[model samples]
Structure formats: C-alpha cells, structure tokens
Target: MFDQKDLDSIRESRQEWESETLEPFLEKGERKERFATVSNHEVDRLYTPEDVSNIDYDEDLGYPGEPPYTRGPYPTMYRGRTWTMRQFAGFGTAEETNERFHYLINEGQTGLSTAFDMPSLMGIDSDHPMSEGEVGKEGVAVDTLRDMEILFDGIDISKISTSFTINPSAAVIYAMYIALADQQGVPREEVRGTLQNDMLKEFIAQKEWVIPPEPSLDVVTDTVEFAVEETPKFHPISVSGYHIREAGSTAVQEAAFTLADGFAYVEDCLDRGLEIDEFAPLLSFFFNSHNSIFEEVAKFRAARRIYSRVMEEWYGAEADESKRLKFHTQTAGQSLTAQQPLNNIVRVTIQALAAVMGGSQSLHTNSYDEALALPSEEAVRVALRTQQIIADESGAADIVDPMGGSFTIEKLTNEMEAEIMAYIEEIKEMGDGSVRDGVLNGIPQGYFHREIQDASYEYQKRVDSGEEVVVGVNEYTIDEEADPDILKIDPETRNRQLERLKAVKDERDDAAVEEMLEELSEAIDNGENVMPYIIDAVKAYVTMGEIMEVFEDHHGAYQETASLA
Candidate 1:
C-alpha cells in the first residue's frame, strides 16, 4: 500500500505530531488512563494506512461472493435482500407459542426461531417427575408430534424458514420437523432451515448435554451426513458462538472456539467418509453481536475470511458455496442491563447495525425487556422493528461492507484472523493434528474452560473496579424504577401439556410405536445413522423422552465436573 519512503515519512510525521500536539493535549486532561473495547482489549488512539499495509486487497479481501470473503459472503449483500429478521420467541404451551409466532409474523417478521423449554431441551416428557414445576417455564414444551402440530398449525413449512434453537435433543426435534414436513407433503429437498445441533459447544460453554461428548458428536455428524443426502437445502448444524460469548468470553475467544468446534465437526464428517463439498455448504454459523460496533464488524469479517481460506486450502473444497461462510447473528443478550432496561433498546440497535454492516444472513434482535423476563408481545414488536428500521430507514444497508476500507477495521480484522488461527492451531496440536480429538481432549481437560474463565474473571474485575464502565451497572447510579410488564407462564400450562401428551399416547397405535422405538434402539446400537429411525419413531408419535431414554440407557448420562482452576 505504501513505498518505503512514504512509510518512513508517515512514521516521522506521526512522531512529530504526537510530541507537539498530542502530548500537550494529554497533559491537560484525559477521560481514562486506558481506552478499551467491551472485551477489554486495549484500543489505539488512531489508525493509518501503515496499520493495514500488509493487507493485500485481492488475496486477503476480494469482492463479495469471492474467496477469502472478508468483504461479504454474497456479491449483492443487502442490495440483493436485507437479512431475514428472525426473532427468537417461545413460552408456555405449543399453542401459546404458536399464537406468538402468528403475532410476530403479522408484525413483519421474516423468519421463525424457536426457543424450547428446559424440559423439552433436556428431552424429558412434560408429565415426567423431573419436569414438575418446570414445564414451559423458559420456552415452549413439546412432548410429541401433537405438540409440534399445534406449534405450526397455520404456518406453511414449505414457504417459511424456521430455526430450531435446541441441542442435546436436537436430533429428536429435527426428526419431528422432518416428519411434519413429510406429513405436509413438502419435499425433503425443498425443506430449508437450521438446527442448533452443536453439542461440542454445549459441553464447552452452555452445559447442556444428554450423553457423553464422543457419542453426542457422532449424533451431530449423523445429522450432517443425513442432511446432505436428504434435505439438501436444510443446514443440519449451526456452529454456535452465541452461548460461548454469553458465558463471558472475549470476542476473539468466541470466534476461535466456535470455529474450532465447527472444524471439529467437519473433520468428524469427513472421517465418516462423507465428501467435504456435500456437507460444507449446508453448515452454518451463529455468532453474538455485542456493543463494540467496530470490533464486532471486524470479527465478522475475519470469521468469513478465515473460514473461506481453511475450506479451500485445508479441506480442498470445490464448490463456491462450500467455501462461503454464511452465518446468523443475534444481538448480545448478556449485554443488557436490568437496572435501566430501556437502555437496551439503544444497545440492541447498535449491535443490530453492526450485524447488518457485518453482513449477517439472518438476525435476531434482543427485546429491551429481555433483561427482566421473557419479552412481552409489545417488547417483541419493538425488537422486530429495530431490524425493520435498520433495513428500510437507516442507510447502513445501502452499501456492502460499509466499513470495508477503514484502516482501523482492516487492522483489527487482520489481527483477529491471526489470533483465532493461532488458537485453532494450538487446539489441533492437542489432538495430534485432529481438531475433533483436540476439542474432545480439551473439553475434559478444561483448556477451554480455563481460557474463558480467565477472560470472564478479568472483565468482571474491570467492571467491579470501575475500569470498564457499564451504564446503569457501575458508572450510573439509579435509585428506583417501576417494573415493566413481564410475560408470565400460565400455571395451568403444565397440566395442559401433560394432557396433550397423554392423548397422543392414547390415540397412537401402541404396537407401532413400540416397533419404531425398537428399530431406533437397534439402529443406535448398531452404530448406523439414527436419523431415519428417529424420524420413523416420531412419525409413530413416540415421545421425545422415550427416544432419549434409549440413548441414556446405551451411553449413560454425563456428569460434568467443574474446572474453575
């Protein structure tokens, strides 16, 4: 970008200006001793062409839709279409959540993102003893195909894309979805959406799993392989960094850990004898967009660049789609403040803008009232409207990679890419050149936990000492405030769900259900792809709990030991 003479002259000029101008100003006053991002990374005062001198426009960041896709994934980006506004919504019974879905769709939401209750996520029937007092507490509870039917009563499965935010039992939910599609006469080839079937991340951060890591990973691989052959348009897995960030990792850790987990899955699928090109295209990612706008945008760019390069250079991927790193962005839920809850609207707006500038394929904006409870209908409307305003009102979407040429952005992007790749290399070495083995090894050994724990601890310390200012949390003092209207789960939700589960059991043919479950158990024990068997069981109205019991009986339950040290 610059000749040696020009670089020397700029360096000399910077020195002179710093001494003559900056020193005098700094002597008078300064806001803080150090300026840092939300992740606590130190920020420099200024950036120039010298900062990004090493970047090659073509090799590092070609045009959108090209290799090393730093600019954006598609050629047109928002010009082709604004990202899908997919608000995450679910609570109480399936019928209730379905009504909320209709409400959101009527308010201009483009896609659906489901949130399952803890019982459903844990693969337990609503009537189970363990599910008492917890049914439909966090999200909707689904016991059988009956619940799924009521969940999507009027929604056309073929027309609208739906994203399921479930892990551990993602295969069960996925089977229910496929069975629904089949019943609706929608071709498996035309079925499109994503499954958050990332169990590795669950072990690393989210702490949600039904079995041990190895078999859980095998199940994830089964979905990928099955999707490649069946539902080609559907993404079998969404490699997630959202929960990792929510667990208090730095932005760099979020990207590194998530991508490492993704590569591990890729390696596992390849080891299973699946072609890279066949499965890579359907693989998608989910990331958190935090308050640090510039850093978030750069992180998204670096992610695309790294993923494209690795797929091409390491995996030898042939198809263009195989190399493209398409992802969904959700505004950081961990950033919202409970004290001044309304302030989160501004935070979400900035985060959503960052995601748009970063070129997210789909987005879910957090409601301002989320810090309090499950977002009220009014709150959800506001959240969806945030995306609408960004797409239609704000000119941010008019240009692709709107922050592309900034010297600061380019420098940060380069640094982030290098740091993430280095972390990945370290993990790869842990497994003797296999990312899958390395992640599995690291999880039990607490490598990832220690790293994220250290980062989280450091950030918390800064906030406690007032080094990092979190509005309404530390810096701003608030006295009292009235509570906003909270979305409450009905007390009768449990009884209703149990009754529905019972009806399904009573009406369905018991012999057929038993037969399907037997076949599913056999398939699992034989180490064959259990997706088809799971689908058969679900179509037979076999309950999620019943299906999961087979897995637990075979693999046993996993009890994680805490590793804070």
Candidate 2:
C-alpha cells in the first residue's frame, strides 16, 4: 500500500516512537510479554502501512465480486441484500418443528434451518428399538415421506430457502425432500435448499458413519450428480466446518479442514464425469463464528482467497461463479455457558457480529438458553432480533467489507492465507496430488482426531489455569438464584411420534413400498443414480432405516482405529 521510501520512513518512525514514547510506559510497568491471537499467531502491538507493505493489492485484495475475491462475494453485498437470517429449529415432532418454522418466518427470519433428531440422522425410524427415549429429543424426527410432508407442510417450497442439518442419512432425507416437492407439484428446478451431505466431515469430526469412507463418499457423489442434472438451483451438499470447529479445532484448522473436504467432494464429482464449472457453483460451506472477532473475520477473507485460487488454478475451474466461495455462518455453540445463562446472549451477539463483519451470506444466531436445552420460543425470537438489530440498527451492514483497508486485518488475512496454503499443500502431497486422498488418509490415521483433541485440551487447560477467562465459566461466579424459563421437550413426544409413524404404515400400501425398495436395490446394484429410486421409495413411505439397510449391507460399517498412529 506504500512506496519503498515511505515504508522505510514509516518503519524508522515506528522504531523511534516505540523507543521514545513506549519505552517509558514499559519501564513504569506496562507488562513485558508478546501477545497472540486465539489461533496462537504472534500479534504486534500496533499495525501500520509498513506492516502490509509487501502486499500487492490487486492480486490479493481485489474488489468484491471479482477474481480472487478477498473483500466480499458479490459486488453490492449487504447493500443489495443483507445476509439471510436463519434460526436452526427442530425438536419434539414434525408438527412441533413446523410450528417453530412458521413462527420464525413470521418473526422476520429470512430462511429455515432444520435440525434432525439423532434417530432421523442415524437413519432409524422413531419406533426402532435403539431409538427408544431418544425420539424427538434433540431435533425433529422423520421416518418417511409422511414425516417429511408434515415437517414442511404449508411452506411454499418455491419461495423459502431451507437448510437441512442431516449428515449420515443425507441422501435418504434429500430423496424425501424431492418427493415432497413432487407431491406438491412444484418444479424440480424451483426446489431451492441445502443438504449437509458431507460424510467426510462426519468421519473426521462427528464420527456418525454407518457406511465406510469410500462408499459414503460415493453416496455424496451420487447426490451431487443427481442435483446437477435435476435441481439446478439447489445445493446438494454443504461442506460443514461448524461441527469441526465445535469439535475444538483452531481457526486455521477449521478453514483448512473444511476447504479440504469441499475439495474432496469436487474430486469425486469429477470422477463421476461432471465438469468443475457445472456443479461447483452449487457447492456451499458452513462455518462456525467463534469469539475471536478479528481472527474470524480474517479467516473468512483468507478462506475466500484460498478457495478462489484453488479452483481457478488447481481444479481448472474457469467460471467465476465456480471460483467464488459461498457459505453460511452460525454463531459458536461451544462459547455458551450453563452458568449465568444470560451471558450466552452476549456471546452469541458477539459471534454473530463477527459473522456479519466477515461477510457471511447466511447466518444463524444461537439462542441464549441453548446450553440448557432446546431454545425457548421467546429466546429464539431474541436470537432472531439480534440479527435484525445488526442489520437495521447497528450500521454494520451499511458498508461492504467495512474492514477491508485496515492494516491489522490486511496483515492477518495475508498471514492466514499463507498458513492455509501451506496446510493445503501438505494435504495435496499426502494424497498424491489429490486433496481428497489426503483427508481420506488422515481420517483413518487419526490426524484430524489427534489435532483437534490436543487443541481442545490446550484450550481447556488455559481456562482451568485462569489464563483464558470465560465470562461465566471461570472468572464470573454468582450464588444468587435465577430461574429463567427453559424449553422442554415433552416426554410423550416419543409416543406421539411413534403413533404417527404406525398410522402412516397402516394407511400406506405395503405392496407398493416393497416394490419400490426392490427397484431401489436393483438400481444400486446396477450402479445407477439411486436418487430416482430413493425418491420412489420415499414417496411409497418406505422407512429411512429400510433404505439405509441396503447401503449398510453393501458398504458395511466402520470401526475407527489408529492407522496414522
């Protein structure tokens, strides 16, 4: 940003100021140690033009909506349209979650994010033996197309964008969604939504796999191929780093791991004969907005730059849309505390603010009482209002990339980009020139597991040692009583959901369901795109477990062991 002579002059002036102006304060006791960011990168006390003198602005910090977009994804950004505010809601039953969805939309939410219960995510029906006591406890329970119909009953599929937080059974759920659209008579191209079909992240972070790595990835590829040919506007998979970050990864690891996972999906799609530009634009990412304000903002910027270059150069993607990285951000759930629960509201607000400043396309602000249970309706409203206040009242969204020119942000963004590139290069080398191979190799060997475990351990140690003071966790203690209302799922929600499942089975034609399953098996055996067959089974009201049983039998289950050790 500055000429050589001016940079040299500034550096000289900085040294003089540090000696003459800062030395006296240090001598009088200003503390004698260096500082670092949450990611543990060294931080200078002050940043100036001299700090970013080596940066080439056009090559690194281009205008928004341009090549190697480091500012924002679009030209107008929030000026044209603010980020979509979505609240991740689902619990108890389909009826209950549908009510929450309607409530959120009526309360000014721009999008819907669904959280499926464990059984639904695991491909088990509500009435399954293993699903006892767990049905509809954490999120909405869906077993068949009947549940899918009720889950999105009256909502117009053409207008509202919905995001599903289902992972392992993403394909089955996606088929259910397509069947729902078909039953509603909506055009397939009009069905806009995102599916978290990222099984690689499941292997590396969540460990919720029913099928082993290779086959699980093929299922993901199947969905990508189906979407490319059928649903033009839909995002078949959201490569999520939110769970990875929630699993305790540092900022750099979160970005690197998430991007690597996206790359793996890209490679798999290419193997299926899909061009990079054809399906790449539909790819999306999900990230966690943690407490570190500047670090998170810089990480977002660096992620865009890294992805843009990777697609354009490494993957041979020619289209600008293919090169751009689009993502949804959710405020960090791990930052919330059970003690002095209201403090969580502030934490969420800060994290949400970081996401907005970081130029998120969509955001989900966690409710204050999420640490206690599912968020109360009132608490969810407050969380929605937080995004509204930031958009309309806080003036933060009035300008695009508001911190683009800051010296500290520029330096941090550059440093982060370099570090992420190094990580990607390592992955590429490991995979023999394929990023997918590298992450796949790492998962069985426990590289991601060990790295995240150590990072979490170190962070907990800091909090325990009082070096890192969590507001309500370590430093703040209160004995006074505060009984805030908590959202509780009815214990009978399980029985009601199970009853509904039975009613659907009793009402549907058993012969049709059997026929659909047989056809689906034939399609799978013939290596045909199973989406059409899965849709047929879903429309016939075949249970999720029944469909996944076919896959489980074919691919078998996985047991994680230390291959990388």
What is candidate 1's CA lDDT for residue 75? Answer: 97
Task: Tell me how many residue pairs clash in candidate 2.
Answer: 1
Model 2, span 402-499: residue lDDT tens: 98989999999988888888887888788999899998898887888988888888888878987677887788787747657988889999999889
Clashing pairs in 1: none
lDDT of 1 at 54: 83
Clashes of each: 0, 1
- List per-prediction Cα lDDT, in the order shown: 0.92, 0.88
Runs of candidate 2 with Cα error greater than 4 angstroms are: 480-483, 562-565
Candidate 2 weakest lDDT stretch, 10 residues: 30-39
State candidate 1's TM-score.
0.98
